[model samples]
Target: MSSTTETFEQYLHNFIESDWLSAIHTLLPEIHEVDRNAVQIWFRFYPLSLFRYLQSAEDLEKAVQGFAMLGRYELKDQIDTSHHFLYGHRYWKTVKAAIEAEAVVFENDDIDLAEEIRQLAAMSAEKLKIDVSLVIAIAAVGMMTLNQTGLENFKNAADGIQKPTGLMAKSPDKIVSERSKDDSQGVFGFLKTVNKKYSIIYDEKRNDGRFAITSDQEIAGASALDRSQNWQEKDSRCWEGVIPVECLSASCGTCWIGVIAGQEKLSEVSRRERKQMKVFGYNQPEGERPFMRLSCQAKASGNATIVIPPWNGVFGKKIYQNVQDVELEPATTSARELRKVVSEAAINKAE
Candidate 1:
């Protein structure tokens, strides 16, 4: 076996030997609280090999990139060509299925198979191409801290503790100043603190709805336009799929915008959003601007605005489905049903 593979096997051994597995399992009751039976079933066939594979990668960067490639290929193969897999939900389901199927297995008795499984997990992580370590870390911590609670309570706890951003600190001045003076009369309280630090603007003509874009000053003149309108019309040439949005909720990743300039003006990160973003491969360390937010989730306080990201995707689920479809080509009934649902949804939405 390669040195990298060996190292990952060792890491997996250490993880299982350490309290991590038991801790995770204990927390599983809390983590899978929402669907105890389902989660229990899933745990029965957890892909230890995939995890070990991820642990084996040279570094987190390689692991993430490899995971992304694997995920894309897998998705292409598994999902029915005619069906569309909603990104997040489908990918997760595929992972669960892979585990259940023991397709990526680690023989509990064989040390070599264990090592191989570690390598596979690392490969899977690389395909994801995002910081899976962060998610794992978050999950670890969550399990450790909130394992006693039920899934719903655990989720609520996560929501409560998840910081909006790493930059925010507890300060009375910062806290009080951020809120509006007129708390009773204004819908502007959320924007108060945010606007003072960043220039905010409303775009009505484009999406036929209100959305904010980050200003050039806040974005440090990264592009030619200092204002949101100019950025949208003249400066937003680099982006594709830039369009108006109807729903601001997670219902549509359509309003998925990027922080070309001021990412710091947005609110603190939430666990759910963070997980979702990672699954979509949008979170980056260097590009960690406060401005990188979904316009709908990002409420403007003062004058914060932002440019759109270059691409928008709804394939978290599709990627995994692609892989499964390829493996089970002869038994295409499930694939057909998925494709039909996706096609119908797409048609309905387009209409």
Candidate 2:
């Protein structure tokens, strides 16, 4: 395994491996207070959506590349966050099915298949209560192990309850969160004391974690753009350590960000922001606040952890293909039945 893969593995491990019910209560006390079940259910299946796209990869190396690509693009556009909230059990079953489909179980004389099954049964029996997040992590780790090694190796590792450690973090490839350490000690440090500023942690590869904005300030992406202006002046299109921003007024979809934490503390999504998000095809109007939000539209009221996408494009209305209209023949059926038939006919015609 490469250092890049190892670093990401550790990051993923730290991000999802937790006693989530307690963790959510700690990090998002308000959310847990109002609806503890909702928060707990959401975090339980968080690993499912996080690891779902990786099922398509043919090998461990490709899976790492897929992970990196996911940081850049919204790959699973069809599966929104609400699906997990409403149908977590079904969603998790599907994820497990995908993983099992990709995984290969050995059936050789040297490997006791029955014993392996019994061990797996014992493990499941031990944790009968729904700690779904840990179960998913275990399966995900097993899949990664199978990819790097063979099925027999995975069985052995699983039997011994040993996590597969393919690669170790190296000095040159250490994933560090970049923070502005000089902010409090500079000549302009006094200016920061005037207002209540909150830190925004960019949780992507760049890990640009030092951008701070005053209370009720414009989104974190804008702050990042201001901080990186010198670099932008050097190269107008540079986005090395900056959150990509084209039109800061929420016109372009270039500044969409995923709120990994502190979402509730952020200012409410405005009417214009909601409309623009729908136009950008990044959000649905089903909820007041969503995990996926336009950074330009979302103001930071407190510290937030956000993930920036790799690329952006305008596809609001363009995502839909042209549809042909159809005239239904008059029938003796009731109006409701006729309308249903017409709808079915139109769908069939579209197909």
Using lDDT, give the best candidate's number. 2
| CA RMSD of each candidate after superposition | 18.0, 15.8
Candidate 1 local lDDT, 170-230, one digit each (tens)? 2323422332221222466455533233333222112321232342221222222332343
lDDT of 2 at 337: 33
Q: Rate the local accuracy (lDDT) of all candidates.
A: 0.32, 0.41
Which pairs, if any, clash in model 2? 72-310
Expressed as tens digits, the lDDT of each residue in 1-351 for candidate 2 is: 444434333333333323333334443332212122333333322333224334444584543432222222322321222222221222333333333433333223232222332333234434455333323322332333333333333333322111212111111122111221112435665566445667776532233434766666767444554554464554343343356655456654556766655677677877666765544435333466666677767876666655555444332332221223333232323323334432332233211
Model 1 RMSD, rounded to 1 decimal: 18.0
lDDT of 1: 0.32
